[model samples]
Target: MSKILIVEDEDAIRRVLKKVLSEENEKFVIDEAADGVDAVAKIKINNYDLVICDIKMPKKDGIEVLNFIKKFNQEINVIMISGHGDLKTAVEAMRTGAFDYIEKPPDLNNLLTSVRGALKAKVVKSGIKKNKSSTKKGKYEIVGESKKISDLKDLIVKIAPTNAKVLILGPNGSGKELVARQIHLNSLRSDGPFIEVNCAAIPSELIESELFGHLKGSFTSAHKDRTGKFEAANNGTLFLDEIGDMSLSAQSKVLRAIQENKIQKVGSEKDIYVDTRVIAATNKNVKKLIESNIFREDLYHRISVIELNVPKLDDRKEDIPDLISFFINLISAQYDKKNITINEKAIKKLSSFDWPGNVRELRNVVERLLILTESDQITDKDIVKFSGK
Candidate 1:
């Protein structure tokens, strides 16, 4: 369900908005305000998913309300309703952080579409914020007791307090992200945001905008101004996952951002300064990439101030029993099932198989076995059948 606010001076318009929105979606909880002053008061007192306000209102206009809400709660989406003559003001409203602008004498479809889009965008932004917060809850706590794990934790504790860049080397699914989060959690800028960008996931053509942002009208499809991860993570950490997959051109820009704590958005000449700690992780050998000239050596040197290597699941076989127990408890809770036990024979069999997908693969196998096994105690037979042994 989405909570929405309708701020308009005219009673008829306000009532019409409420009726249209309510009829469109029963889940929408719509609130009305006579003007900007009333809207601001309501905004402060309540949490709303979207706010639609008329540009010309008595006492406090929509622009004032937009500015106040942006300063207080940037997460809340706003849509400005303006008269045909207020087109200039509407554009200004967008510049001042309104999600979008709609001409007055509202078309039902246009109003509904803009509101729906704003709500969907709010949901995505909220999800990202939640994910970031959840990732930060225990940035330093390494969840293992093995000697290798303990040593890594100790190293992280010692190195995390510095502004030094860290290069985390590990195999796929080896918890490299966990290591990166630990460094950020323990760093001097722990309170600041920790933004993550997957270099491999972003297309090479769009990687620049993803990192440094883009100006309005910077390129085709750039309908409005956008902030990049670098700007968003100012005074914080930016974790670049799969850095080895980043293109040569993107690597140069990354190098510049590290060398000088400044970046120029695509199609913009002005440099935006950011105080960000860069932590990069890769499953591939960066040195080999440099040797092949696919990855820039200078950038590698800039980001590799300190390097931490996470061992693969095979190398950490001693931790298998503990890992199995941990997964069983975690999976059981998540699936709403009672905890299952792993027999000694099953443990031995698991230890023997080479986990090509590392810890993630192990977790999946555990969940599968838990679902398929008839007995509460998992044995070698269950492992063999499920694991394709």
Candidate 2:
């Protein structure tokens, strides 16, 4: 059941909100508080999913309560209740971290809608956070018995036990990230956090603040203090995916962190020491980038103490059958469908195709086949039709 707190000084309003929410959703356990002080006290003890707070109250106001929630539990959604006079204050409450505001004499429909949306968002963010923490053994398990795979597994074992930084090189979707995770899982920091950052996905301006945190009020949108990836992955592994696409400025900050074992947050001067293992990956060329003056040669040398390469899917066609079987079982369970069998002819057709998108691409094709196939078994015609280049 989801817990919610209703903070209003007026007893009638608080009682009405409690009744409305309870009638709307019997699962929501709503708690009422007459003042901000009582509200903060209850919040300290209970893990409330959502908080509906009034702006005006005796002793401690909604702004103070909102600020308190932002500092202690940033995930909790707080919705402000504003009177006609409190409209401007409600707008300010948003900047201070309240999720959204509803004008006083709350509209039942609008209130329910905001509450439902906030609770849904909370569930999604919570699920994503937990999904990031996977078991050590299963997450990095590589399938197949081909010579190329065997050689790669052997290389992983050799480097997994070391503290040296590793740089993975490969074509797009060729399992460079799996190699990085395997190294982390096999290393001494297996029990610690395995934080993965896609350098290419982050915007150029905010990359620094992303890797190293920023303080509240550091910028226009920095309403609350945030923790960065480096700090999050302390005493653990930090996987920098697509390092080739990172900005030159961000690269220099990363170099300092790797070299000195310390990082400074974007708006702070204090250097924080982080005992993190760096594993960087990219499909771009270090030599060409260095020659072009886009990438720093010194940083490349710092990150590439142990270099490893992942082969393309087309180069490992012998493993396609095992990969197909693995995907059938995994995808069937995920989608709640029966696992389909593929004949030798179908396997040959899949193996014959040039998988330019590599292992990642193969998985997508398998999922598509699983969802679209008419029969209980997969065939060459299915492969030909669904496995489009």
Candidate 3:
């Protein structure tokens, strides 16, 4: 049911409008405001789908009420009730954010039609807002029972709802990008696009064009119009992986983009607006980079609203069992084999060694074990031979 507020000083007209609205739609929950002051108070305190206010009121006029409501809550749909002689005010009210206008001696069909149309518009607007918010959320799913993994998951849940920029720090195979994805998935903009750019992978010369885009014929190889990552991720997220390796010049542009929420294409004179949530990840110590004068201090601050440190494989050895099991299942399905079980001795042997490449390395070992082990049940000797334990 949609909530609606009716604001009019006269009790007779207020009651008549309420009755007409109620009679027209049984689903509408109608509330009455004696004057503009009361209407503004109700609008602030309650969530109303629509507000219908008379042009002239005791404390404040309909125009004031309309302007106030729009400034406070742009989502609320409003309809202005004006006297026959107040047609000019009614039109002005529409320009001031009123959904529609109706003459004071209200026509039933006109009032009903306007109310229905306003409600429909409100619904459509609300859907767009919801979708925009969803796009900013990232997608990351890491299942584990280890305390470190569990704590990371808890942290992500707490931080994802906010608009804070995050910097994920971890080793190359420690799933830093996964954590970044999880943060985006949980954020308000999850429904928006999740654009990933590997800074280290892009060539230094082309990094600017890749990130901020460029106009056609701006450069020798420029063949067509292109939108940059920032533009593509408008109202969404931009994940910068291996940020520590980004070139100094690119760092300057990135810093500007983060600070201004705007980007200028490499060859274009025009600046494009972007509402993007930034999630940066790096395997190297950004602090060390800053000390070495490789990373920009200003850019680091711009992206690090919150920092998440992903634990390495050796740091969380207790998780080996679960990780091993997960990989076994994953590889078993890929190799078209029945779910295989590993012996306790084999798990112990696997857990005893230091995983230099972290979870990714462990997964490869599991796949190797699956391929080499002749029996359905993997033994310690098989793990030792295949994993080179």
Q: TM-score for every candidate vs. truth?
A: 0.63, 0.64, 0.65
Sorted by lDDT (best first), the order is 2, 1, 3
lDDT at residue 15 of model 1 (Cα atoms): 88
| CA RMSD of all predictions | 16.4, 18.9, 13.2
Give the winner by TM-score: 2 or 3: 3
Candidate 1 pairs with clashing backbones: none
Misplaced by over 4 Å in model 1 are 1-141
Regions of model 2 farther than 4 Å from truth: 1-136
Q: Compose the digit string of candidate 2's lDDT tens values, residues 27-63.
A: 9999999999999999999999999999999899999
- What is the C-alpha local distance difference test score of each model? 0.82, 0.83, 0.81
Q: Residue-wise lDDT of candidate 3 within 239-311, one digit each (tens)?
A: 9999999999999999878755678998877877677778899999898999999999878866775678899
- The better candidate by lDDT, 2 or 3, is 2
Extract clashing residue pairs from model 2.
none
What candidate 3 gets wrong by more than 4 Å, as runs, is 1-140
